[model samples]
Target: MLAGKVSLKTVRSFVLHVFVLAFSCLMIYPVLWMLSSSLKEGNEIFVNAHKLIPSVWTFSNYAEGFKGYSGQSFMVFLKNSFIVTISSVLGTVLSCTVVAYGFARISFKGAAFFFGCMMMTMMLPAEVLTIPQYIFFHKIGWVNTFAPLIIPSFFGTAFFIFLVVQFLRGLPAELDESARVDGCGHGGILFRILLPLLVPVLITVSIFKFYWTWDDFFSPLLYLTKPEMATVALALKNMSDNTFGTSWGMVFAMSIVSLAPVFLIFIALQKYIVEGISTTGMKG
Candidate 1:
């Protein structure tokens, strides 16, 4: 009977592995194809769609992309992307984490009702509020600037707050009580004790916020009128359109380069993400 059970478990594990491998290939194939296409000359790509190996891999496209395209410089756009991504990530993490603590740990009148409203904000799509945000920013003279990009992060984003609140609620209550016994206020407990334990969730939030803000095109497109203010995402979009008869190689090269950082960060923190997200559902 035990042998039969063991055999069944092994079979189940094998099937799961096979399924995972198949799905992994399905997901990874496109990335592999894109990398190959990016390295291939523009003319050869259409001709050799099935080729796993580029007939002749040329670094020229990537080289040109880095050097600059048309009027916009890739380096400048990269710098702008870094600034927007880093600033927004920091702002969102700090603001969202603190607000989440308020909802998760603190007891106040109407707290549950207000938290429900906060969650409802996520249910509404951003498209519904896009025009309203644009008009509000316009009235405040924040149009065509980074203020629209940076300031909203200070108030705290709904999704990030929700994620963090879940994770914070999962942590043991003993730590908060211990801090209280030590004469530490809520701020000290949050900053000193809880924050240390919340590392996994924090990293998870940072990874997500960084990637989303980095790749964000619409917000920058709506607000940034000047070419100098263009971010990496918008720069990529405009670079393709503006550079007529320009090298497609450079475009692909820049795309690959842009994709690398987010990929690395996600892979590094995937384990923490799984743990932090999973533990949230258990009340104890």
Candidate 2:
């Protein structure tokens, strides 16, 4: 009976492993297809969509994709993306941490009411505010600039604030009292006592902001007009020509290139991201 049970368990484990492997391949196939298609000749991409490996491998797609529009190389788009992404990440981390600290530590009138209002904002669809935001930015003459992309991040976002607030609530309040006893003001309490403990959540926030800002296509498209100011997302979109034939290979190549930063950032900081999320909301 013991040997029969062992054999059954082994068979179940084998079946589970095979199922997981098949599911992983199914999920990864599209990315593999895109990578393969990027190396393929333009005409061969559609014809050979079923194949994971290209018969005619060439680096010309990457070369042609880098030969960007209006005398600018793809490097310019990448630079624009990096500038916006980095600035936005910094602004988000700074503003969200400050706002979250206030919510988590400070006791003041209507603090609960204000926190509730902030949380309510997260429930509303971002699309609902787009027109209003556009009108407001236009009135301030901030349209067509990186200001539109990076400025709002400084004001504080509800999601990041909530994440940080949850993490902060989990920390021991005794730390704050001890810091105060040691002659630390509110600023010192925050910067000296709490900030070090907040590193994981801050990294999580930075990673989230980095990916969001980098992958953002619609906002850049809506605000930026000049070809020179275009981000990688916009530049990639522009790579497709309807009047002329679209360069599928180049588009795929640049798409793959655009994914590199996101992949690298996630791989590097995934540990902190997982830890931050798993720990959030676990404490009062």
Candidate 3:
């Protein structure tokens, strides 16, 4: 009976492994196709769309895509994207941490009410605020610049604030008391005691900020007009000229390039991301 049960368990494990492997291949096939297409000639892309490996591999798509449009190279767009992404990440981490710490640790008049309002903002759809934000930014002369992309991040975001708040709540209040006894004020307690412990969540916040800002297309499209000021997302869109003909190979090449940083960052910090999400009271 024991031997029979062992054999059944082994068979079940083998089946599960096969199922998971098949599902992973299904998920990865599109990316593989895109990578393959990026190396193929424009005409051959559609004709050989089903093929995973190209018959004639070429690097000209990457060359042409990097050559860029108008007066700027793809490097210029990448630089603009890096500037916006880095600045936004810094601003988000700073603002969100402070705001979340306040909500989590400090108590004052109307604090609960204010926190409730902030939570409500998360429930509100971003599309609902688009018109109002555009009007406001336009009135302030921020419509045509990176200011529109970078400035609002300084005010803190609902999701990041919430994440940090949850993480902060999990931390023991005794740390704050101990810090106070050591002549540390609230700022000192935050900076000296809590911040070090909050590294995982901060990394999570940074990862979120990095990817969102890097991948943002709609805001850049809505605000930026000059080709020189375009981000990678906007530049990729500009690369596709349907008026003449879309360069499918170049588009695919640039898309692959655009995805590189996000993939690298995620791979490098995946452990921290998993730890942060798992331990930060998100499971409930």
Candidate 4:
């Protein structure tokens, strides 16, 4: 009976894998098509949607796209994206972890109420605050600058804090108690004992923030006016003016370049991310 059950589980697992693989193919198909299309001539793309092979493969589209911009090179857009993403990730991690520790460890007045308010921010749509946030930034002279794209991250993000708090709560309290008994202050205990153990969750938050900031467009559109200030997303949006003159090939090449960093970051740090999520709500 046990052997039969094991065989049944194996079959179920295989079925699930097949389903997942099929779904993955469906999702990846458009990307593959875009890449293939990018290699073909501008005329060939519309002329031959049914044709899988390019009429003529050319790397010139990518070259021409690079030369397409007058003041802003693709390289510069890449650099600007990296700057915004890295700074925002660092800011979010620092602010979120500290705030999470406060909510998880401290027992001050109105703590629960304040935490509820934090959660409420998550429920609010970005559209609701977009205009007001733009206005507020305008008042503070942040428009048309990296400050608008990158500065909001310095303030602790509510979602990251909440995620961290849950993970922290699941951590064993005895560690904190032992640290306290050894004459360690809250700050010391947090720095020496807690933060070190919270590495998984910290990594998770960093990865999420990095990806989101790298891909965000609305804020950049609202905040940055200069063509040089465009992120990868904005660059893609402002790609082509001529209905027939659009360089789909270069667009594909640039997109792949844009996604490369995110893929690398995730692969390098994915272990910590999964570990952090797995450990959440398990602390006794």
Q: Clashes in each model (backbone N, CA, C under 3 Å)?
A: 0, 0, 0, 2
lDDT of 4 by residue, 1-284 (tens): 46656787788988999999999988888877777777778777778575667879987767766653646788878888888989998899888888888899989999999999999998788899889889999999988788977788989888889888988999999999999999999888889999989987888888778778888888888887777887777777777545435677777767777778877876898776566547543211
Tens-place lDDT per residue, model 3, 1-284, is 46656787788988999999999999999999999999998889999579988889999999988888886889999999999999999999999999999999999999899999998998798988888999999899997799999999999998899999988999999999999999999899999899999998898899878888999998999899899999999998988767526788988999999999988987899886677667653321
For TM-score, the strongest prediction is 2
Q: For candidate 1, lDDT tens digit of each residue in 12-65?
A: 988999999999988888888878888898888768586769989888788788
Residue-level lDDT of model 2, residues 105-155, one tens digit each, is 999999999999998998798999899999999899988889999999999
**Candidate 4: deviation at residue 267, Å?**
3.7
- Stretches of candidate 2 above 4 Å error? 1-6, 275-284
RMSD of 1: 4.8
| TM match of model 1 to true structure | 0.85
| Whole-model lDDT, model 1 | 0.83
Candidate 3 off by > 4 Å: 1-6, 275-284
Q: What is the lDDT of residue 43 in candidate 3?
A: 83
Q: All candidates' lDDT scores?
A: 0.83, 0.89, 0.90, 0.80
By TM-score, the candidates rank as 2, 3, 1, 4
List candidate 4 stretches off by more than 4 Å: 1-23, 50-56, 243-245, 269-284
Candidate with better TM-score, 2 vs 4: 2
Lowest-scoring 10 consecutive residues by lDDT in candidate 4?
275-284
For candidate 3, the 10 contiguous residues with the lowest summed lDDT are 275-284
